[model samples]
Target: MSRARPFPAAATLGILALSACTGPQSALDPAGEDAAEIAGLFWQMLAGAAVIWCLVLGGSVLASWRGRSLWQVATALKVILWAGAVFPTVVLAGLLIHGLRLMPGLRATESDLRIEVVGERFWWRVIYHRDGAPPVTSANEIRLPAGATVEFILSSPDVIHSFWIPPLGGKTDLIPGRTTRQVLRPTKPGVYRGACAEFCGASHALMALTAEVMTPDDFARWLQAEAGPAAVTAGPGPDAFLRHGCAACHTVRGTEANALVGPDLTHLGSRHTVGAGILANSPAAIARFVAHADTLKPEIRMPSYAMLPETELRLLADWLASLR
Candidate 1:
């Protein structure tokens, strides 16, 4: 009896899966110095594994099919001893030493920019520590100057979360009451997705952030703008945002909406996403999130304002969108 094969389907699926290894969040498609070294290590290890696999499997097939005619018992034993044990040991030891050699460069701490990223529930609170100025606070999104080494001081206030931007570097856990530092030198100016790699709560999977790498001049302009107050100071949206008790949690630097319970809304309109990357940054999305945040992100700390009138929601969303 003969058996049928599914090689065509398997081959198609394998190609599709491999195609996913080259995107914004792919470690294999690294865009930074640390990530490039990590990717190199991965490829080297993969090559070593492939060589070992081919040799071991080929030897097994040859032994089962034609070994008796080709080798004496003593020679076969010698082959098994060296091939099964000694070869793997040497290869793995070499790989380990190569991996260890990369640690010092990856762990270098003398950075040009310092940013503190705090994991709170399902959102990221990003604070920029400038050289000669007070720390600027933002949320959900991080911007870095391309070609500069940036150090991130990571921590969590409640539970453990892992800060990982695959295109840049490795994952660093954010443990409560303690800090973990990771340095990344971004070489590309593009938007990369970041996420919490640890499972923390009901909405852990939705905890995502955007990291945009910019040129030095552009980053300076952005930082200057972000350090300032809200661009839209007075309007119907600002009025509704404050009048409906939104000020109790959020902060809009130029206005009276100064509270730290929620994400800093000082430049909320400028970000790419709402509710920490759960929704696109638009007037309608903002209105929907403001009215139903709990539904959009499960078990979140933000209270829902489902009762807000549609017109008011639109106004507030417009005001926030104009804040840039």
Candidate 2:
């Protein structure tokens, strides 16, 4: 028997890289009810297009090869009528109606939780609302309970930005001065990547966030912890933060840093990433961001503290990390 030829290593690598399509950020891998519906619609349309393509193109090739017989001409005309016009009309109309029917059900009748998300220039301002409780404000990351319907009321303080969590729900535009709502029922407990799908401005590519879907009990615990004020400690970090006039733009709960120009840092230590998910939430990463934020994220309004002493920067990173 002849030996089969081995696949090239580069081709194998390419195939392996395609696995990224099904990763946590992929629309092909639906982890929530809304994404599943959208994926289903996409697959159905793709299959229909493939069938139409085969019928139209294959029929044309066959007609050209077969002589100009009356039978061939009649058959080609019939195929053109059905595949080119009738089939497409019927298929598109059906898909349109199916999509319309799916829309109303996608909006959950009863939401287990409500979150107000405001799109800033390059970050997300998240407010978790509770019944008879003060809103818990955070930034760049959203935590939700798996297997629960959560409603997001989205708006923009500046320009338009689209909120899209591929594995969770569809894209919803955050229009300034207008509130848009989207409902998501995440079925899996994992971190889903989200970003601004619309082109806002400079650093729009860096405008990303993480959606942490946890079990109901764990979500409750996290919510409680986030609802409280920032953890106070006897450290130089808080002093350094204040001394540098960081309070003029950012806010850390239970302190005098109540400026609304930037993101809330009350639970910054607990977040998975910093600088709008541009960096991992580590001491070194935090220190680098605090010292040279503009270098990492250009055009950001937060000024760089590259002149600060290394010791003070380290203390500031440690203090922020200790908030958890």
Candidate 3:
């Protein structure tokens, strides 16, 4: 026995009233090559609803305009049973199948590069694994070869967090003691922003990261530079970095500080933002972050270094920025 109820004309009008909730224009909309296919299937579901709404509302207007009695609602009900209920169910089920069919492509199977992103209270540590080579580590920055499948294994050292890159895909949770993997193939060459979707603690707002998708050749060059050790500490930039005990918590390749407690600053100079992802990767921003990090993000494990003179802070920031 069929138990489906016919939808009313008013129901169709109600869906149209909510049509504004559909996909709105935004910079955050993932516009990757694969995104079109994803978006197409999504909008098809929306279109099905819109079409049903139009038919129901239009049929109501036609029925009323034809001098039919409002009591003839039974006839309208019969039409809705055929068009609204029977029709939409078929349409929606088909759309669901179509959307689900794209899942295999989302999951990678080819030779994909593996990168592990670890989220903490106020920072992100990105570790890239290369074949037959040592791991490359950096803070709040990730670079990948365009058109390659980069599988990101996400985890949190402490609390729960979420890794979200709007232009790439959606957010994936980073749970402590568990690894969540997200695979993304970069089709476009550009810098993409990411953030911690879930609030972990006081510095949650400041925790952010960036994905720098580049040409295969450009990515190769970056990897080469990262594999090398820091340049000679002859200048005031490297001099101040060492003399000030900055290496105590941070690590630069071939330097004394190899502690994994904090993010590796080997390539800090190449990043676009500092203090996690709260501020732009500029000299002033870096200086401000290193100086007032504790105040800017209260309860941060890092101590305030603002007691240093502005001139020394500027020099340190400049030297760090020159790292890349």
Candidate 4:
């Protein structure tokens, strides 16, 4: 008895699976829009090659089934070889040229705003360039105008580090005594997550940041507030902020803390992350760092003053928070 032929479901499923494999659109795939276009072009080339392969292989099989002479096999081989060699070369060359043209836009420029970003031991510093010589300072969070051009000039205070903002652009390494730059112009206004792409030291994994893209007016107001002095201080926190010798490593503009060994905390309250984005910019987080800097960040140069009472911690946090 003759056996029944198999159903064509296998071939149909294979085709569908092949189609699904061609579109690359996930976070794990980091090529951005350019990669998708390139993948599409590659799929087209592959489909053309697949068609030739099926035609040649199927013709050879059909010829054998029909009891044609072996010479028909040689003809199919010649057609397959010539078509495979000529078509892919021409098509790939065209794709390469087309891709090269798109490359310039991949590195395109925009007249968006410029923001200078600095990397530190456990935090980040940002300086918005204005018409005059603006004071350099550090904020736990970065705010930018939506649809603005942001050119980050990255440099490290001590060791080498990397800056990465996932939604807007790729990683750029910041080296000591050198400046590296990346430009970004996000169309949407929202928060973007960032981290230190390069391993700096003990606390490398914990260092993270947020990129807050805001409306133009809000950004301007933030700049103005940062340019001004810390809000009026009136409690024990002010005394502690001074007596505790925090100024030796941090500088608050218009204050005596002119130290440059650490970040310029002139606008600390306005920032959202602390210790180089290791922790949130909240009263509890700030108090924890002040009380036990080593527990939160091991081997950190900043010494802990955990002996301070919770009331004092709250006072310090309130004072720092009032700086906005």
Candidate 5:
């Protein structure tokens, strides 16, 4: 007999790497109760399919055997009927009922915490709502208390976009002039990755964010800090910001930069990433982003400040970094 070809090592390694699925963004990890339920359903369906496939294949082989008799043919026909017809109908019905039962739990009714997320062309405008307090604005990062149900009211100002955090819950669409909502109750305290699941525009692939699940006490502290205004500092950066006509589209608390065309830079320094989570939040990164935001995220609305002098760019970056 001819020898079989050996499996390629490189291909095997690549397949294994893909199957790892250990990232924080993976739905298979299931960090929350809702995610766990979804994952369980997926596994159940997969197992059912495998069982049916094996039964059908085994019956076909047995029926085609050269020595098969009438008794074997009858048995194979019976197996095919049960595995292909009865089994599928029963499994689908069960799945449908189970999914319907889980629907109410996935919906948001009333929550102690609510967050409004507006989807822009390639970024996220986040607003935190608290009782008897002014709304706090942030961008590209969502912070929530672990073990508490939080509601997210989502909307889009332009094209349709979808908000999805795989380890927490399902994808919810953000349509222009229409509002949608999703409820999440994370059971783990960790950082999870989120992204725009819908194709909106050129920079849609780069429209990503981070969800930080923290303890109740820590979340309270963070919320309090975020509600406050940016710290005041004396620097040439403020004058340069206004000189460059940046105030017409951005906002900085306690300053005259109250325009709303872009994300609020009032607490920019406190964020972990910039350029819609495309760049790390550092002095050097900020400088590059300020000069070449369009280069980092193509087709963005922000203009490139590549014409600015090196010193002025550095000064602007420093000023933004000091906002925290």
Candidate 6:
């Protein structure tokens, strides 16, 4: 066999690296107002650093070219003093001022919508607090209206978890028994990924969420729909879900399965992911997750339903998948 082409391998690696620069989770690929500001600051700071680097590099080259001359040595000392200290201080101060100006916008408490997000062990609980309605409860997904400022009231019930959606803005820490806040204004209607930036436990890496930005009209309709109860409450799946004691932990509104120990599954089927983005939402995925919750997401509070019969598991999955 012929040896692999070195140039081709390098090119492939370069392509892979470049592909990461623009994606759903990239901070540089900003889709929101705050993110755009952050990206601009990043580029400006990078340029300042580059200028400092060039000045120092050029001075070093001059010193090397004019080696062993006392006059040139004095000149090099002056160059080092200016390039290594004065230039960096001024550039850093300017960048710091630019960065500080962004803090007020991020800290602005006034918003068109207020969302309370509670971080659990390996999942998220989302509650929308609209002005004229009771809070709407959901899980694992966040929906926002494009071009509107949204204030996220964040907290963790157990450990510290940093909630971050890089394409939207910076990370905010969620501490137990204390509330923190972050505000973001999305300018584009698109799908993005959010994650728990802090390490919580065995399944910390799997703690992920999806954020979808919609138009004002579309978001209002979705929120109205989400406020209602499950569409399928009398099916065999509901029966099986109750029979297996899943109701003790989960709540499917408009039915007797009301409990607050776990996430509300009233509209589980409507969501795009199951097990907090570990699997796509579908009957097969639901069945697999129901049958082996522990294996799918280790250390989660939801116990595995492996003891349930295969037929009942199918019924449960089908019924849940129709929840939308």
- Model 5 segments more than 4 A misplaced: 1-15, 64-81
Candidates 1 and 3, the one with greater lDDT: 1
Residue 177 accuracy (lDDT) in model 1: 92
- Residues 3-36, candidate 6: write the lDDT tens digits: 8899999999999997988988899999899999
Candidate 1 stretches with Cα past 4 Å from truth are 1-15, 67-73
TM-score of each: 0.93, 0.93, 0.80, 0.69, 0.90, 0.93
In candidate 1, position 101 carries an lDDT of 90
Q: Clashing residue pairs in candidate 6, if any?
A: none
Off by over 4 Å in 3: 1-31, 53-85, 232-239, 242-245
CA RMSD, predictions in order: 2.7, 2.6, 8.8, 7.6, 3.1, 2.3
lDDT, candidate 5, 1-324, per-residue tens: 966556776788889987866677988888788888888887888897798788777767876884457367778688668866898888789888989999998885977799999999899999999999899998889999989989999999899999999998889999998999999988899988899999998999999988888999999999998888777544588888888999999988777888988998888888888887788789899999989989888999999999999999999898898888
Put down candidate 4 lDDT per residue, 1-324, tens digits, no spaces: 966545677788788775654221222222234334444555676787798689878877876887555457788678667766876788678878987886654445664555677777766777777766565455546777876666677888788889876655556799999987776665556665678889888888767777777788887887777777666544566678778788888777766667776667766777767776677788777788788888888777788988887787888877776676
Which residue pairs come into collision in candidate 5?
none
Model 1 Cα lDDT, one tens digit per residue, 196-258: 999999999999999999999999999999999999888787899889999998999989998
CA lDDT of each candidate?
0.91, 0.89, 0.77, 0.70, 0.87, 0.90
Q: Candidate 3's residue-wise lDDT over 1-324, tens digit each?
A: 966555766688789766643332212355353455555655776687797788878877977787566547888788779776887788768877876787777666664689889987888888889899998888788888888888888998799999877666656899999998877776777877778889899878777777788899999998888888765445787668777888778887766656677778777777887887678788898898889889888888778898889899999888777777
Candidates 3 and 6, the one with greater lDDT = 6
Q: Report the Cα lDDT for candidate 1.
A: 0.91
The number of residue pairs in model 4 that clash at the backbone is 5
lDDT of 6 at 59: 63
